[model samples]
Target: MPTQSDSTPTESARLLGRTRPAVRIAGYSAVLRTRALLTLAVLIAILCTLFALDISTGEFHIPLGRVLDVLGGGGSRAQRFVIFDSRLPRALTAVIVGAALGLAGAITQSILHNPLASPDILGITSGASCGAVLILAGTGGATTGIAATLGIPLAALAGGLLTAVAIYLLAWGRTTTGDHGVMGFRLVLIGIGVNAALLSVVSWLLTRATLTDAAHAQLWLTGSLDRSDWSTLVPAGIGLGITLLIAAASSRTLAALRFGTDTTRVLGVRIQTQQALLLGAGVIAAALATAAAGPVGFVGLAAPQIARRLLRTPGEPIVASTLIGAIAVVGADLVSRTILPVDLPVGVVTAAVGGPFMLYLLVRANRKATL
Candidate 1:
């Protein structure tokens, strides 16, 4: 209805190969809502603040200004030692491990088309936990040495990959409608069975192990961070870097799969192969995170769902989910360390939060179905 030279804002932006009016720079542009961008910025700032508090607020209680000085390479020898050798590793490990779980959750939920789907549902976390428990029982509470740092993580990785493969095989089938695909429902059910069996095995091992070993195994099962160090941080960081690259590269294919198998196939993706590839990347991320943090329950489930709602994304929001996960885990750690008289595991806090949220989501999903 407009006359010549009166193009709409959207049209003008499109013609300029841009979407957002505020973020134009040298022929490049991006589309993002102002409120959403502000929300993201706030989240980032909060995360930074939390990360600082995590390193500074302990028995020693370094000030925030001093914490920044330490970070910028200006603290005393004692401050540097505490920040570099003790607190920094734990905080970084928590952030990276949470990022891994969030990315894995995003992948699994997208492919399965279920908000509840996660590494736990796929049996990866359970498998990793089982493997770690086995190691603890075998070593008789020897979690102080190099064996704990390397051996447990390697075992967890192996267990996660094996569980994923088993789930895929068990769920593979041609539907009665003559369509061949992996059934998500079947996979989840089979994974539940596997998890139960593995948990029983863990219990048996703990019963046979020394009391000290049993205690250690129980603490690990609770997902405590009593043992986080540079060793845990390094591997988690490496895995996250790899995951980010793979997820970015395969995002389009993953996006297509979210629309269902027919759509992915129509987009020229080999359904089985692409699924395997995507699932493997997710498994790697989940496994590495579990290896680092000992099955921090519910972060994987909560982070992506929270991110999707906060960002209002049609598909899974990978970056937002990762940030949300970091916030959840770090914040949980803070609460565990400060709020309670006794130290509770971060996993326990997350479970307490996520369990109710999950029930609410289910109720909502049911109500929507009724409507």
Candidate 2:
């Protein structure tokens, strides 16, 4: 008998399969919503257009047609070199880095049940920055031997992972019934404390460094894409691919989590296991982004919120947030590099714009409920 519960949202649906031609699998009948799909499609189109424009706006100034020709292997050697070797890497890096941060932010926020629970907020980016800055200050600005560029990313990744692990451990709880895991509010508080400490460490390191060393470290710490190239691109791309796979495989679990711990347990979700998996995946996503782009701020913090507002998804809008992150980064980078007479760091662009939006969101959220 078809249950009357079907009239409601898919919270009660078993799991829908082969829902559409290319989109396969899924839990919850409401997984595919029309407005949300349209929003995602539109965001993707905007991203592609921005990508073409980004490639075409450099010093050499290749037109859209010429950029397409070079991308399609029909342009002259000079055009090909400029498009493929120079501009494409920066634009692609921006997209992937933003997407990774956005996905991470969505996962973290959903897990914590708070809009402000992002990588930057949770001390992950601060930890990464501290590690990278340590290397820069110690090695005299990442210019000495293998310690220069290579050490920065490696140290940052390690620092982020370590910080995430610590936060999880500190937030872990034991119930009277013998269950144990993290609580959202506790995690946020611990993260804030850790972030402050890490920021102090970064500041101390910068102060100890020479002028040139400090300058290099500071520039990178701003999350600019200036240093991006094939080296950064390859690893960031691989990390994003792995992230998407993890996200797809864990969608049902994340959805279950959305309904609260009691409901999650009733629905057969191994609560501890699911949280750990999601948290680990999110940390890797954010850390990989920091490794590639030096902890680009606010993209992780703002993109997921934007996606949620736009798509109005019941569960975490992971896919939408990823696309929005990509779009945000590319658009911001374009503005930083083009509209401004000087080549401003992309991080500056995001922070300057996203800060006010974030403030407004906080005010609106406060109006709805006390925090």
Candidate 3:
């Protein structure tokens, strides 16, 4: 009945031992890995579909077939113009900026061991917003033209980096002798205070500026893809690529750090140095995304948490969060353009969605703490 006799448990174990052990894992872990991969694949598919749809259903209303033809280099001149000149740039920017914010969020949350940690909440985005508002005010609200386009990103980057430095210093000082690493709660509290201060600064600038300048600054602060084009996309994409490489190289360190400072130190990682390096990478990523899209709200805050919940993982899934961030932005941009009576800024939609979700997280965390 048994062909060559069924192997015993011992025999099977011996056979497995003889095979490559590196790939072997427990059944539950294997299942989780498979699920995560499948989830990522599904998210990718969804994003691709949304991307095509985004290019398809603008004011001109090109069909999906024509969009594909244009993408494939086989469309009419007008079709090509509409696809390439008008719509494609915005879609690409949304995806790129979203992914950047997502990665930044993942790094911040993982490193700090706090689900609520995000660049937006940590004053980084507010800092970028402050820089952008300064530029708008200084230039008399000249948000268009060549100079303004180039200037905003640089200012935002500087502001974000400065804010990051400030936060690091403030959080570091609160660290006692017993505190082996940055305290997540302390860092978050300091960040919130900094965020409030920066927002006050932004508000003050807006009030002092002329009406036109104030309006322009307000629009940019709300986050929109109106400014995105080849020029913006190229530099932002490059920055994202560089930061992503740094994050990838630091993946093992990130993984270790997630287990807390003691475990990471035991694993021979220099705690403060590794944390600083990772935080720097996160700041650059957030700044780049903010520079491109003018501090798109709630994306960096929500993406990693959504991905972690989707994958049911203890730690944030970096790739999944990145994909989810792209999806959220692209989807929000789509809704902003098509579903509304008037075209609205992308951040408006995201804030609307993310606000309630954030409340839910706070409530859940409170309940857990009580329990």
Candidate 4:
């Protein structure tokens, strides 16, 4: 019995109400999909740029065309040797170390639900540093030599694994859920203690060593890509690839863990098992990277944070982190080599850049907490 105009207004309102939710949902879906696609494209482009930069920018500059020819197996002997022999191993090593650190950071951050968590947070870097220092102090020669190469990497792995196990054990307390229960705060506290103790040991050893050994140890501690050879590259590449695959596969479980351990358990994720696996993977990744380069700092801490921001995702994106990490290290290495007249240590450069960013993050987090 209502007038036609009145009925028309009511119908229009109903149509808007029905369509609004649909439009909003469609818009959200489109945004998410677009973000994912953009992340992928950025990753691909960055990788290509890294490869080009690695081959083209060095003391003996190779033209882009010749670099491509070398890559394609159609270059002169000199070009092939420079590209394949000299640069390829170091470039590949950078990628392996960078990806490993990035993935490790992503896993640690997700599991801890703390953006500050990284391989260093668990004392892995400190452990590796201790091992390398010991080898340099104890072994009476260049720590980067063929003999020390085998010993150093093994020692680093052993040190990292031992430190991780110790932290896990010390943090574990009896709980109804399981025998090994970790209190996050307690774990972090213990890791700090371990890191401090290991650093003290390294300092003592450095003082006792000869001047030559001390200098070599200092360079290793600062971190460098100067000595990466086929020997270091092959093992690092194999380990990095394996760990990256595992991290990617665990992304779903990691996402569930952001809620809480109990929620992850409710979702049928093996919380304890996954935690152990991820921690172990993170330690191994960090260890291999340390051995390949030398405690290359901040890649593990900064790469994941940057990746999350770039992707604009709420939770950690492991794949995106890996890509961003690769870009970060390669880019940093390029800067270290080209920006400075003399070669700068990669670790020094990362620390210089990441140190400020870390302080800013800490301040922001503190302000938010106070508010």
Error of 3 at 264 (Å): 0.8
Better of 1 and 2 by TM-score: 1
Q: Candidate 4, residues 1-371: lDDT per residue as tens digits? A: 76756657678888766652222464443223566777779797988787688878887899988888889989889888888888988888888888889888888888877777787766888898787678867764354556555777787888889988998899788644564577566777888788888888888889999988887788778878887788887666766877877777786777887776667778998877888898888888888788788888888888888888887888778888888777777887888888877789888888888899888878988999999
TM-score (all chains, Cα) for each model: 0.90, 0.88, 0.90, 0.87
Candidate number achieving the greatest lDDT relative to the actual structure: 3
Clashing residue pairs in all predictions, respectively, total: 0, 1, 0, 0
CA lDDT, every prediction? 0.83, 0.83, 0.86, 0.80
Give residue 171's lDDT in candidate 3 (0 to 100): 84
Model 2 spans with C-alpha error above 4 angstroms: 1-32, 140-150, 174-179
Candidate 4 local Cα displacement, residue 336, angstroms: 1.2
Clashing pairs in 2: 142-148
Candidate 4: count the clashes: 0
Residue 196 Cα positional deviation in candidate 3, in Å, after optimal superposition:
0.5
lDDT tens digits, residue span 260-333, model 3: 55677799998889888888888888887887888788888899999999999888888999999999999999
Clashing pairs in 4: none
